[model samples]
Target: MIVMNRFARRAAYFLIIATTMGAVLCTRVLTSVHAQATAPTTDKAVAIMDPTLISRGEYLAKLGDCAGCHTAPKQGAPFAGGLAMGSPFGTIYSTNITPDRQTGIGHYSYAEFERALRDGVAPGGKRLYPAMPYASFTKISDADMLALYAYFMHGVLPVSNRPPETMLPFPFSQRWGLFFWDTAFVRHERFKQDDKRDAQWNRGAYLVQSLGHCGACHTPRGAGFEERGYDESSRLYLTGGANDNWFAPNLTGDLGSGLGRLSPHDIAAFLKSGHGAAVHIVTFGSMVQVVEDSAQYFTDDDLNAIAHYLKSLPAREPSGAYNPQSQKAQEMAVSLKTGDVEHPGAGLYLAFCAKCHQTDGRGVLQKFPALAGNPTVLALDTTSLLRLVIEGGASPQTLNGPPTRKMPAFANQFTDAEIASVLTFVRTSWGNEARPVAKRDVAVLRGKLKK
Candidate 1:
């Protein structure tokens, strides 16, 4: 009787949600039809595809990192899609953006492209998932949108690659449900210039908030999975967020886990080469892809602007601090030289880590990233660190950057408890003051990685 009652309750709950979503969807359809019918048609002249426009579009595409998502690794042609993006609901495969009539956006008009990029509504009323980052793309200016369209239509090579269909389960599978999601969460506004701010800052803001979509990864999400804040207007903007098991650390002016320690030039250099010489920090995880595919190609002026904008953001929810002359750091250095394995993970650090990351936790410049004050090491969330240690990672290969340096995995070398202890030691020692990593935390992550 209890099991039956529980099943009945579950059914009723689903019914309520389904009924609400259906009603909302129907209302949206009617409203959309009416809006389209009533909307005045304008016969705007299409601009001639000049070299300059096409070149700008190509640059914009890189800035947007369109290839990052659309180009499936070792599988699909550039922008031919088939990339499987894992979401909370299920796997959402990227659609082919190449100019292939049957399989891509070849049939899409500028209007259709605009709607899809800005409003998340594709042709035939097909709703794109938020995984597309249209919310941020919506801020792109009219001129920039035109350039992007021109590039996609004329500059890019067409491929008739039909990527796998993304069929998420039940409620999430219902594309119409996103109508309400858009209405409530998406801010349908173009990039607005701040009269008070300089052109450089505004340009940086436009690129970061719109084409760059840095906030898509850096900004925290709300209950509906909407970005908590779009720009610097809200305190939560760029304070850090996790995506695909890696934590994109805070980009605000927080001394420990943010860009606070680095100068504007350092930030620009980091974007260009994936190495911040000022702080001895290097890109890891998904950021390596960004640097390789997008940021490395950015013009010097634009990189500086981005760096300036990031530098301007005030600190929020600050945690962790680094001091090179701390007593703990001194003691650790002494212990390492004296063969004292007194500290919990000191012996392991000497045996495994000290060779690359020096006894003092400072790494080789432009080769291995320093562990002492590295933002990834001091981040509140230990997911990235844990994964990096267990699974290993490589530095991005860039036009000007050093040859890619690989970190070896220790999954088989150490036990979960040992991993946790080493991480905890690293986090706390060498003037890095962050929380400890528990054995359970390491075990949970390891188990997840296995599957």
Candidate 2:
């Protein structure tokens, strides 16, 4: 009887332990769910900072192109954030980055802000979509991060406006799914200086991979639509990809489509001046904004460093031949002259373009880019070409001084069909074999400009 009583006591003890374990597990699950639903709450007062810190922060912000994405082209407010970015998943609107207490990031502590920038997680454990470019931001040094926080918190004016909530399709809408992606791809570490490389190279690498986040546009996306990687090890890095409506050209040393023909000095000159002195190229489309907002502000040393890093990148073969001197090109050029007297494209080119580009399509050196054998002109994607035709662009002032060369906006003068016809002529002529620009494409871009 005594032995049976002892056994019963032991059984009771086991039951109590099991019950305690289950309750603890339930509490943990409930807490996690609650945290996921709520954003971080803060009542801390804004810290007063010195001008030096604020100025540094402002520079960092520009370096990252914060305003380019956060501000709509012609909408609400800067950093109050209502820009709708299109992705394979769906449209994602940028969040208000202003320091407003309720609708913006005014409540974010330095730790919280760092978490969002580096780990792609928000205050409430909510995962940010890859569109935030946290993968690149993750490489930002702690000093820079602190400066950025100071700028946003103390420097800029806060607005109470909250951006529209982003709604993705079914499985994608589940923000929790990003946890796996972050774990698999995003590097949470800070930028490290490579001892083997010179100071300039390392600085360039950090800026390109982290602050500048060049890979965001220049790197090709994988099947999951994430950038392949931000470093030289990845095959897709800097081989070029589309940025919204424009195709960022290959930045590697590829002979045909990339910067193989240009020297490091030429690159630095282009970055500093927004036009190549020796290489025949001009900044337009997104590149124009990059120059105006970011690259133009970089120090001469930093610009050279960036150029050096880009020059050092191993070459990747361009997909297609960029042969303007080939027999096919000569035939196309002949066809342009002979095909149709009433062909709006041919006539337009002869009347509008021949003066600058010359009758043979070989533009004057350093004045106008030649249509033949130019990477921008021969690019498979015709967004820049179309942009140049309809909107017009100008070369930025260089160390040499103010720019006199400018392309006048044709949007006011030409109909969409006329623009398309002229662009189609340019694309087909002089051995350029890119697909013709469509009137619909021109119309869509024009409509956006009006808005």
The Cα local distance difference test for each model comes to: 0.86, 0.75
Clash count for each candidate, listed in order shown: 0, 0
lDDT per residue, candidate 1, 1-451, as tens digits? Answer: 6535644554454445555666566676676565344221343224526668878999999999999999999856999999998765668999999988999999987878888998898899899999999999999998898888889988999999988999976666778767767866788789999999999999999999999999999998775678998999989899999887788899999999998899998899899999985777889999999999999999999999999899989988687898879887788778777777577888898899989998888898889889998888888889999999899999999999989999999999999989999999999888899999999989888876781
Where does candidate 2 have its weakest 10-residue lDDT segment? 39-48
Which pairs, if any, clash in model 2? none
Best by lDDT: 1
Taking every candidate in turn, the Cα RMSD to the unseen true structure, in Å, is: 3.7, 12.8
lDDT of 2 at 3: 37
Query: Each model's TM-score, in the order given?
Result: 0.92, 0.75
Over 4 Å off in model 2, which ranges? Answer: 1-48, 75-77, 320-348, 362-368, 386-451
- Candidate 1: C-alpha RMSD to true structure equals 3.7
